[model samples]
Target: MLEELYRQVQCPVLAQLEIGVTPCALVFLDAEASGSPNLRCGDAFSYVAQAVTLNRSLLNAGLPQLTIATNAIDLVDDYLSRLDAEIRPAVFPLRPSLDLAKETRFYGAHFKLDLLEQMALTLPANRLLLLLDTDVIAQHGLDPDLLRRCHASGVGAFDISDQEFSAYGSTRVIDDLELVAGRPLRNPRWFGGECLIVSAEFVGQLVPVARACFGRYRAVIPDLNHQGDEAFISAALNILSERGQAIIDIGAYRMVGRHWSGSTHRDLRWFRGCALLHLPGCKALLGRQANRRTFSSARLWRRLVLKHELNRLVWSLRLHVQSRRRDKAIADSPEAPSQTW
Candidate 1:
């Protein structure tokens, strides 16, 4: 299944670069090192949730062999130990040479985002990469055929709600975004990387662009509670899309399958192909105990959109209204005040 996804997602890059390699998913975990007191930031409970979800989500998706690079190696090991044999992940100490840890400056959240960009660079430039946030986990299993939309060549990003130009606290993010794209950033769907899929071919070029954007962001935003890496990533995607790269919006490809959840509610919704879940701003979840939770005890709140016409009509209307409201917010947004952490 992974090989199929690999072939589908990397095909475009391969055609361009004319390079080939074995097909396999190189899964990675990027999170704040809460176990290291010096690097810790945000609620420890949230990190706990991220780790716990990573383990269970991978297990549920039947994906194992996760490679981790973190300051909190021991803590990650503890969580992986809980997973059964086939699903247990392996931990790797972060390479010092790749140590882009910027905890000294950005808040823990920023540091994690920086780390995520770094991890994208460190993956071997010969295989497929599945870079997931600690907060995102598998809501259900994966079927490669069902993931066809996500499998198309180049870079694929999750569709997220809170991704407009105003999404970032630092106004610089928006400015940098426009600068990168060489035009006003315009997109109805905000590009999200929480569960990002990248072909090795683009990573080499992607890192520098992301790093430049990150540097510009850090130079401007002088505080903790700023938006994470998604904005910078959006900048990269905008650039790539302009360059004729196959940057697939996973949500649109899957049509009604994969949905983005920016709400913090415990309620879960599943579309036909909805596989992974991103827990972004749930007040009940974040800034608190990310304490490792049990996946076994949890049950799917909803699954496979009902085939009824009434239900489908209602869902379609709700989505249209939500999209309109979001677009209006971004379009009507006033000039943002500059921010300092």
Candidate 2:
């Protein structure tokens, strides 16, 4: 079923890109689950194909030569058969020593490890490597100047929602970042795991740390699951920053969207000229009803007004009901005191 969908979805995208075999790679880890009513293997395959299609289009438009790296076991070749001949897939085998018994809440850690390992092995010694998540679908073609800016930035990272940590029970992850970065880690207004760019030198530095951290934690915390790759990354930056390393140098252009709280801040006026806009969570935001979409504003006045009105209405209703209940309870009392008392 997905084969048909892949052909329908991917072929057109390839045609749209008009790309001859390029040097860029689009990497994805396998979907973890076996099967479900809402999402089957076929569905996963189709979704990945759609993502690749969008990525390929972006690459062809001007990003860079693309290559895809993923775990060998997870990526099915048959699904990729229809892609353009220029597109190549590099598969990395799962590490033999990785203990499967060590449970992790951080599913993204697996993908991050796979990406870092592949980058360490296959990435050119001094070229740029863009690491985009499988779920990210590029809506616009990247300009070459933007690619240059990312390369020049030394390291590029995106933000995720602060709310996700509590939702995922990952306060410990925040502590880890603070320890590594040294200073208190400021929670970005917007947080998510959508995209990252790594220079060859940065990859060399980060791969070892990521492996060590994953290995150590997997052994001790058998049940720590979380989804913030950026958190782990932020921790790494903290470590480098303490050592006086130029941890993350934002490039000439900011490569994320204005909708993100981190990007929306008035303090982020510096990023006004950024080239890439990480549009994580925009799809769901776009899907919401108009009333719900009003919450996307970063303005304090707007939010306070909306919140105040809502709270007033709810509290007024609650107080009225509570007063009536109290009066009735007194009337029902057998030896009621005087009303004034």
Candidate 3:
């Protein structure tokens, strides 16, 4: 079943690149189509800007980078064309799986699993693969020894089991996954989808099980109750751990801070110490940081609290209206013509 997903990947540069020789970072971006109601930004270009900024940070950290993108390939190419060859990653084109897109709640969340399955098939065994969401920004180079230790442990993920948000309540994830599995799980955990550190060997084991678990979940769970990739993968990890797989909680090591500036859970002090930060609520700030070529944690907070709140409120209202208008248009539209011509 996973083999079908490989059709979306076009890795023209994979042959030229060396994979297992050193650590590599895989950043995934799926640009929402033009004129769509994008929650992250006003348009797709802002998302591309964030991705470019992220790729640069990974390159600066002395790691080879690979970017998997859909729809924004032209924009990414244009952006990388202006930069020096040293900073540009081998950007692979991944057409979004339309079926999975409709099946999942989030637009592109499950694409990571597809890419992970692809990586498992392609990359050398036990090679370190740091999968990062486009929203993540690196403040400093990651520690090599620390990364190796995490890699040695089979998998490393930021534990979000205790963190609860309205959209995705982490507390209920285990129970929900258990319901999907049709049995109770042992030592199950919930992870934020922002950053995941995995070995290619581990991925080979993980993706199959994750996909299977997700298949069961999608079949049994209601569309409204469906959680995205993180929960499904966590369920698979928990199952594997019970069978003697090592799943390390990288949150304890402060590898990455999942920071949303607009939320009450925002912790700048803790975020400062982490090498990577996932700023989901600050896409506009990410665009600004990308364009300015400077990143300041202090500036992020100031802008979010002082300026962006009102703008965000306005944007939200505008988006809501646009969505309603689109829905009404679809609902009122005439049926398609017959093919009997």
Candidate 4:
């Protein structure tokens, strides 16, 4: 299934890149060593396989460089041998001396450490770093020209949401920027953390500082309160702001299977612009509903068109079921009052 997804998307991406130009390299920071129970091993393997296929496709398409970075040296060795040396994977080890002390489980800190390890292996000032999560899969190849345009325009981020920014206190920095730009920087949106494109220059500027900050603060700070790399990024932005550095805000990109929590329908607007779709929980849902003939794409379209009515029906059914359960519970209760409210 992973290989199939790669074949579908990677072929087109490679065909589009210029022959002489240096191609972008996709990077992932494997966090398998952290032993976090929340970490899904299957998802990690699927992601790595997809990356391997992408690397192979890009090389076949004539891209100059394709690399993978991971702290799992043995895993990297096994993967390269399995691929028959088709994909060149890079091994990055965690600093042996760095103390990773924690009172309880710290997922965010683990992620920050992983990011730092990946960043350390990046070559200086030329290549584009395509950072992605283990659960995310590319649906379509990115537009090379569009990516270049974004870099040229100094766009730091794409698909950022205001809510996420507020959650991270990034809005405070944006408000400060508004004061400098002499305009309001309102209604900023948050971007998902699944994928990001970072230029070598930006990485050079931010990665070191983020590492230093994390290293300095990791031991003393409470695990629950620490915001990890994202918060560190927010801090880096703050530092840059103080130095009069400009931040370019690129608007949202199309992302499918993300808003599935709200509704199952795909947003056409997202499809038109998004290069990737994050199917975090869709695997189970799609599998379960696969046998239902009524849940086909055509029927899904019908559901979208009549969303309100369907939602109402679902809500009514839930309410009725809840009422019956409540009544039954009350009837069985020994201390139940006779008066019905």
Q: Supply the global lDDT for candidate 3.
A: 0.63
Candidates sorted by TM-score, best first = 3, 1, 2, 4
Q: Give the per-residue lDDT of model 1 (tens digit) for 43-155.
A: 44345445544665566655544555555667756765655554445555543323334453323433434444456555554444666655555545544432343334556
Q: What's the lDDT of the predicted structure labeled candidate 1?
A: 0.49
The alpha-carbon RMSD values of the candidates against the true structure, listed in the order shown, are 9.8, 14.8, 13.9, 11.8
lDDT of 2: 0.45
The clash numbers for all candidates, in the given order, read 10, 35, 0, 11
* C-alpha lDDT of candidate 4 relative to the true structure: 0.44
Better candidate number, 2 or 4, judged by TM-score: 2
| Best model number under TM-score | 3
Segments of candidate 4 deviating more than 4 angstroms: 1-47, 53-66, 84-98, 102-126, 144-146, 153-155, 163-192, 215-227, 250-272, 282-341
Stretches of candidate 2 exceeding 4 Å from the true structure? 1-42, 73-75, 83-109, 139-153, 159-173, 176-192, 219-228, 249-252, 258-341
Q: Let me know the TM-score candidate 3 reaches against the reference structure.
A: 0.70
List where candidate 3 sits over 4 angstroms from the true fold: 1-42, 60-66, 69-75, 82-87, 95-98, 101-103, 121-126, 165-171, 221-226, 262-266, 293-341
TM per candidate comes to 0.58, 0.53, 0.70, 0.52
User: In model 1, what lDDT does residue 169 have?
Assistant: 35
* Per-candidate local distance difference test: 0.49, 0.45, 0.63, 0.44
Instruction: Tell how far residue 90 is off in model 4, in angstroms.
Output: 6.2
lDDT of 2 at 308: 41
lDDT tens digits, residue span 55-102, model 3: 666665554564644445676688768766654556666554424545
| Higher-scoring candidate on lDDT, 1 or 2 | 1
Error of 1 at 51 (Å): 2.0
